[model samples]
Target: MGVAAAQVVDPGSFKVHHVMFTELRKLVDRIIQIFPKIEAARPRCSSGIKALCSLNSAIDKAKLLLQYCSESSKLYLAITTDAIVSRCHKSKSLLEQGLCQIQSMVPVMLAVEISQIVDDLRAAKFIPDEFDEEAGKVVRELLQRGASASDSMEYAEIKALQTAASRLHITSLTAILIEKRSIKRLLEKVSDSDQQKKKILRYLLYLLRKYANQIIEEQTDDTTDRNEGAFGSNDPNTNFMHAHAFNVESGLENKGYDSHSDKLSIATLPEEFRCPISSRLMYDPVIIASGQTFERIWIQKWLDDGNDTCPKTGMKLAHLSLTQNATMKDMISKWCKKYGITIQDPSMQPDVPHLLETSSISIASFGSYINDLRLPLDISNISLGSLDASYTSDGSRNKNGDGLNLAPEQNSDDLRRDHSSGNASKLDLESLSSLAELDWESQYKMVEDMKNHLESDDLACFSMSSENFIEPLIKFLSTAHDLHDIRALKAGFQLLSTFLNQYRSGIRCLNEDTYSLLSLFLDSEVTKEILDIMEVLSCHRSCRSKIAASGAIISLLNILHSNIIDSRERAIKILRNLSLSTDVCSDLVCLECIPKFVPFLQDTTLARHCIVVLRNLCCNEEARASIAQTPGCIGSVAILLEIGSHEDQEHALDILLSLCSQCVEYCQLVMDESDIFAALFDVSVNGSEKGKASALELLRLLRVTNHDDRQQECFESSNVAPEDANNHAKEKKSHKALFGVKFPIFSKKKK
Candidate 1:
């Protein structure tokens, strides 16, 4: 058996026991060679059937090995599986075969299996005297290499054999039988010989008889069950109706070949003759020049109704709605190359069955269909409250907080209805003509009256600036905007913004109405101007007071974050200023601003600005500590190291060092996360002497903690335990300067 296995690897041999497996591998290589020559070959031969068959066979073999290894413990199982897999991968065109081999090895990885053994040992408290120490060492190495079971083993085949031997108590010879069974089963499926078919039938019959009765008994239930559907079962034909129906051999009976044809003679070709493209009845097919290319006229007719292309390869047919057959042909060539499948003609294979299915358009196209069926226009009516702030802005208030001029004002609807004849709020240009009867100049004066009254900066103006009083303000803010009106528009929004911020959380203020006013300034005309205002407000001591106010500087910053029309540099600059602000930075942190900042690190244009801000924040002990605790800050630190400028790296090191000083163990915590250590390697190596000194110091601090725990023992020491000396060496390496400070030995030590 071993000699036969050895012969399978030779490309020239076909008489080996593994002949089927060897042929499949060679077939894949030949298919790969023919793939590029497809365009020049004869039609109906372009479908890369051979390559696909080989790939499928290799995958089946790998799956078999995995199954056999799971069920049996034997060294021969490992050896045989490895030998067959290695044979499958000896050619460049066998990528699919190699992938299958790699995938099979994953289940047998020594690192993974050993790790599992260790876990089982710990769980069951099983420790054979000889295996205990070696098992512990294996576990430690596995952890250090990231717990990948396969990675720790030098050879996956060896690992598989060893694990099966240790855990399942089976000899290597028995393992070989399981592997042989798997290989035989695969060959049974691929072979077309009558003898092979009989053998397979006998094997399957044995398996079914052995398991059928037990399976049936387990499925029997005592509990009553409801009917799942209208699958009435008494009539014999009821099942016959559900059984797959086949049409008579298409196009042949019409040709007077009725001698062997029954009244409705049906032809069932072997499974291999079924069209891989459209598995149904084949039709008018003409062979094209290619390895596996075939052109079928009326190809679209095979794809059920309303379909135009092949569902599997997206290939357009000779008679379809395709705009360009040549373009589609090119696309099909690329698709075949990607999947390594040959193109087959539906018409030429008259004996083959081509199955019909619905067209496989992308799901996104269904949404387009729904949208196309929607109404062309929609109308909705909304009622908004009156906008007036005169009570607080223009009205007189005394020391007792009593209103001096409190009078009811006319509602906008009443003015529009009594004088203009309808709701001017709902009016478009056509409806504006109905307002001709009203004193237009006087109505404009009333708007002026409302606008002036809402601009007051005092808290007494809260009532007039309430959300109900801001309707007119919203209308004015929503005016026809252009660069010409930008300054005027910015001034209006700024006033509305100021009024809302002062009174937003107050009893009379309407918070929702404030955002409506803020949205108007989102126009590109004045985006820059609004960001400038945000920058100024961020600098204000009073900015903190307005943090709870509706849509202040933070709102502006959010708008900036979302606006991509302008370079993100503008947004980053504004955020940098806000991040630097004593009043805003703390509030920003409280808002958990790391998510907003992290993406900016990825933006090449805004990255420098973001890094500067991060550096500055880290420079402050409190801010750096707070940022370190952010959800993604540890990952963000690694990113910053990869892309940050030299100065930024130095500053980050300083912050980390300061954090270490304040919390001596903090350094160890960050170092424990491998990603953080990886990040530091980029930044800590090239800094100035002072900066490098601090990094080394932080490293030393972490080492001392390791020393105290006796976790490592790889350093030189004569009297002290190796583990203790390892701790000392780590700490010493961390502080080169400190290590150089030598201690004197007394002359009495010579005794």
Candidate 2:
């Protein structure tokens, strides 16, 4: 004031002072208005609002100092202004700190309040209108931002809301508000510097996966219980589901409930928790008409990809509509809450767009693509038998050069008669020629159609003439011997197998040329098909002779040694059928097929077939003697009597009876086993009528043989004459004297 008086207070100085005072007044008024808004936004918790009140008190004290300074003298004004400036700076500092503190706590406080509201909603507990409106507002605000557009702050808010909703078990609302794809997008958007956001996203995903897994488990348990009730506790199918569920539960337990702040990695997530389609945790699951449930986005994308069928079932979609799986969504939410993982808004998910170019690809183009990737053409070049080497040059001559030319005018009756006589039908020849000219793809399709025909229509397959097909089939096999043309060979074998299986007379159609071709295939790589063909061929007496003569039995025996069950079964079946013929049985015996057949009796599935073969072989004395001489043959059959089925035991006992009846030594061999008598007794009492009769008869025969042998031994030992006894004693004394002399001579030689 003294300085102002001395200077005579110029207009510029007065104007500067006025401007300063005006600006200060405006600042104070603005802060006054801001205080109430800050108070209103402050969290309702006592701790949350304490900082805001302190900030308000500081601002009020500064305002009081400013108001008091306007009425004071210049000197006093200067002192009061200093105090006001100090208070204003203090209040400004406090306000900034309070704002940050409040902002930090806002998410937590909102989470708590919203959780309460959600709990109320879930329990159907009374919620005030204001509380309901507030929760709805928060949910709407979080969902307003698209997942791709949302930043870290918005993501945090959405996560808080989702956590609350999930805790309340409001699955439908949670799914609607926070989608899985949106969380993935938010996670992707998080930069390296934003580790907090990344962590939050990861935690939210963990919760999603955990809860999804739990829901799946609960549903699985429910389903298993229901299935157990419906199908009974012994259902094998339900055991698989229970095992899978247990594995998933065990995985979750091993993972434990890690803290949300800890660095949980994606690799830790269980694969079963992931969607089968996307191979990620399911967000919004929907059930398709096929009864399979998948995440909505992926399923929708699959539908949009021009796939008109369910991926799992491959059944045509009756309708593409997805039914919301509310239960799964609830489970995902609860899993997150249990593990302290925060969930983000559903709206933040990214849009999974389909590739437009895929729709333009055609099946024909796809086939061409496969063809381009096929093995090199030169690899298919192999020296196959020439068509002209065996068949007529003009295709008009038969094997004996009997010019069996068929003109186009030949009637169906003539064709039938020729086919019945094992000659190629002209129609079949033309068909085979046409088939040979077709491409590989066409040929494969034809073969598949033929297989289907064989499976579905036995009469049609039998009625179809094999003559035309056989020649072409033989030609096809010879030409397709190259590894590159394996499909053609496979198809040819399949057609041949079907032809032989359906029509017994079809085996006769194999002339010398065809027989040689078929014999060559018996040693080829397609053993399964060839075995099946041979099995059918062995059904006919003439074919069995031809096959045995061609030395195909060796190939069949080789197949029996393979570890493959189907091939072994088929081989045994063929041998069993062929053994019905005495000549074949003798050949089998010479070839040592008995040892191979013996071990198969242990297998329940093959036991019946094996016993049949042995039974047929036993018809011939040489074959029976061969079987009885084989090691473990009698014991293996004895085991079958103990453990085999009713039919098996019957057959096994019959084989044993036949073998033992052949010679007393064989009966003694069977009787020597420790458990043979017990097994026979058990079978006699508990076995089927046929089995019981067989066991009883065998038991009686064994007892009679034993009685006779014992009687003969006793009769010979007790009925010795006195003169013979004296002679025997003299011979014993002479044997002892010779041993005594030899002992000294042998000892002297060793010394």
Which candidate's TM-score is highest? 2
Error of 2 at 85 (Å): 99
How does candidate 2 fare on TM-score? 0.38
Candidate 1 colliding pairs, count: 36
Question: lDDT of each prediction vs. the true structure?
Answer: 0.38, 0.54
Q: Per-residue alpha-carbon lDDT of model 1 for 60-88, expressed as tens digits?
A: 23222222223221222222333323433
Question: What range of 10 consecutive residues in model 2 has the weakest lDDT sum?
Answer: 1-10
Cα displacement (Å) at residue 304, model 2:
77
**C-alpha lDDT of candidate 1 relative to the true structure:** 0.38
Q: Model 1: residues >4 Å from true position, as ranges?
A: 1-487, 490-525, 536-553, 560-568, 615-626, 629-632, 662-665, 673-685, 688-690, 709-751
